[model samples]
Target: MSAPLEGVRVIDLTHHLGGPLATMALAQLGADVVKVEPPEGDQWRAVDDVRGESRVFHAVNRGKRGVVLDLGTEEGRAALHRLVDGADVLVHSFAPGVAERLGAGAAELTGRNPRLVHCSLSAFGPGGRRGTDVALQSESGLVAANGGRVMPVPAHDTVAPWIMVSGILAALLERERSGRGQVVETSLLEASAALAAHRLIEEDSGEPLFNRFVGALYRTYRTADGAVALACYAPRLHARALTALGLGHLLDDPRFADLPSRARHSDELAVLIGERLAAEPSANWLTALDAAGLPHGEVADRPFSLLDHPDAAAIGLVVEVDDPTLGRERATGPPLRFSRTPPRPGGPAPRLGEHTAEVVGVSVGAGGGR
Candidate 1:
């Protein structure tokens, strides 16, 4: 069997993380994705988040060809329509009304290619009275929920891209039978709300229920030399973990008697676990946990190199991409695996406009476009 999207072509007009990462997901699944950048390159390329590292650009934009086009000109817009004629999918992350002004609006695009699955990622949904430039987390209400401090993870920037991937895939699936394409819309607002799906279905007690990580043996703890993240929820595993830690005596204690009481005294249990855990290094605890068949392991930080985490390769969680400019760098691999048509590693992230002539039939330098 061939890769799922082996013959698909994607036109990526998204700039920052969410949109590019979405297309990257498709590319990893075997789409011939071509990213279209403005003359100055994707705005993410200018992001200096890690101080001299191209974290935003190289990381999210890998496994795709790139072309530069100054859509401010008619020629550039013409080139886009040409690309759309042959594209199976078109994804963009432009702000409200911006795509229309640039002749890349959904109506214009579908007019050129009615069978195109147009997926759009936006900070807000499509039309609005007015728009303000804000961080995705703020727009998604994550900052308010986190007491006004913006978190870098699980917010719209990262989570929304996966939503885009799903939306695109669903649209593609629909096109299979309908013999037509339709618009797929996803936004940071929707993505953030998805993070709180439980709130939507649960009864409104009118009391805020957040920061619920108070259960015993179901959290991270510091060991003598490192930390261990333990999952002790299952009844069998709960007993096994306590026996492994030699803390079975805790069951007889009045304050920590049953599972309910143990949950109520999660703080005390944590302290007691910490007291014993402090007596040995994480390696020893890991050995004991493994021997006792308890589900636990040492907590690890981001690896600066593969040497920092020898187990990264062993687990198959990360894949290596030979970035043309950044050299060999590790990126997250495709999340899924197919039995017969398993995805293969894709090509490196392209240099800015490196494929302009080949993809668009013109040189970006011909117009002083980056």
Candidate 2:
């Protein structure tokens, strides 16, 4: 099947994680995306390089042509305007008001091209101070909620891109009927809030939901060999787990009778369960859990272990691409699938100014700075 955005064109003016990830998804959906960088290139390109190519940059910038336009100069800004005039979408990640100074603001470009889908990505929403993943996580209560330990994964930076994609797609769908495009805005702060949405609820007494531990449920326990996560939260599942682990006597214990009671005596109940689980290897516990129809997973120490797992490959979650500098690379595949218009994984990320002449009819030397 043909790709959904086969004929669409996107002008990418994003840097770092959020905006680049969104534009990368557009390219995966078969859009003709032209990634515009300043003369020095995206600042992220200097971070964590492999053979002079930024692994951080390449991870989110696959399958797009690249051009280096120094938006600081009139000539460079003018070149960007020419690309925007004929583009279907434009995405930028400038600080709140920097886009206007660079002449890439939504109002000016969208006014010129009434059908343009202009998307602005920010660290924080308008009128708020600029922020980052760590700051937003703190402001959104994620840090406090997660026991005051900083998260290893960049939750806000990762989630904001998908949020941007959803907003941009909605705008594009609306344009089909209205014949006019609109501005789409998303921020890391908003994405952080979305991550904590479920935890936002509170009881009348001001007690937050799920704040207390509930026995041996919804947490990881160490086994003889490794660790396994158990999630027998519901009453029925809890009974099954007890029965499966030869602890059926606990089903009738007064202290472990219900959710509230379990929370009150969680430490004792956990000791009972953890002791039993530690008697066997993770494989044995996983097998028993599966037979009981309980939810569980054997925790993997390395995150990249999933790249080679058969389960991930079965769902097309892994893909391989050939990079000019890094050779063959294994990364995540396109997450969405359609029966009629399936999305395809994009090719390798382009070299800096790789398509400048082909795209703009002139070669801009690869000098540093915009």
Candidate 3:
């Protein structure tokens, strides 16, 4: 079976995680993605925290061909124009106005190919005063929102790529009907703002109660080993939770009988539940919770290592790539899966200018040729 985007050609001028992830998604859908790098190559290629290679870079740029060029040079610029001339999409993450300066802006590229989809990624959006600024995680409100809380992660950077990818796909579908391409834009700020959609709604509702309460039983509790997150919001489940914890007598107590009253005594309830959970290990509690049909699970304590995760392997989340320079390495697989034509690992990350000669039809130094 043919891939969904088998005939589509994408010129990827993106660097770092966000843009590459977007292009990777397209590549997974069978788009012919040609990654164009500067003479020095992407900065992410140097992130060697793991033993072998930069798994992060490999994860995002799989299923695509790589070509390095000095875009500042006349020859390189000319070659890039040639590649864009036949391309269906162009993905870039340069700061505001940089693309225009490089003569590869949305307006310029779309003028050359009217049907070409141009996707731009940035730290901030094009509208704000900091549009051109490359703000780190703290400036985007992402780190702040998640920090000092129970959950902490760099959600903005991690989620921005997927959002940009979705935006690009939507733009491509729109082009199908309109026969005219438009610029698809996403930013860490915007993506982060989108993530706060729920909080924004709650804030707008102007209800103090909505902000403060989490129901009585639907919260985190400490177990003997670690912690267990439990959700017994409904009356029946709450009763079951009480019985499972040997607190069935609390069901008769008027202070913990109803939802509103339970909220009022949440602290007391939490203390009681904590005391009970402290008596048993997390594994025992998990088994008991499962038997009681209570929604609870042991909270993992270890940091997430991508290597050898069962879900990752079962769903093809990681793939092995044989690199001519780095030997063999395992990196993340495509985020999407197609029933008809599933995406395959194209190859390992290329060396600087690895395909310059092949792409531009000219020979370079030794170990490089057409």
Winner by lDDT: 2
Q: Per-residue lDDT tens digits of candidate 2, residues 98-126?
A: 89999899899998999999998898786
TM-score of each: 0.87, 0.95, 0.85
Rank list by TM-score: 2, 1, 3
The better-scoring model by TM-score among 2 and 3 is 2
For model 2, the stretches where C-alpha displacement exceeds 4 angstroms are 202-207, 211-215, 364-370
Per residue, candidate 1 scores C-alpha lDDT tens digits across 55-161 of 66877877899898888888888888889999999999888888899888889898889999988877768874223224656765668877898774545667788
List the candidates ranked by lDDT, beginning with the highest.
Answer: 2, 1, 3
lDDT value, residue 282 of candidate 1 = 90
1-370 in candidate 3: lDDT tens per residue? 6677889999999987777877887787788888888765688877764544566777678778878766776677778888888888998988888788777888888888898888888776754433322354456554465563423445665677788777777888898899988888888788667767666444456566443353557877887778888887766677788888889899789978866677778888888898998888888888888999888756667766655677789998877888765677777777678787877556776555666677667732213321
Off by over 4 Å in 3: 49-53, 127-140, 147-152, 202-205, 209-220, 231-237, 325-328, 363-370
In candidate 1, stretches whose alpha carbon ends up further than 4 angstroms from where it belongs are 48-55, 128-149, 152-154, 199-201, 204-214, 301-311, 364-370
lDDT of 2: 0.87
What lDDT, from 0 to 1, does candidate 3 have?
0.75
Q: Report how far residue 339 has shifted in candidate 1, in Å.
A: 1.5
Q: In terms of lDDT, which candidate is stronger, 1 or 2?
A: 2
- Cα error of candidate 2 at position 309, Å: 2.5
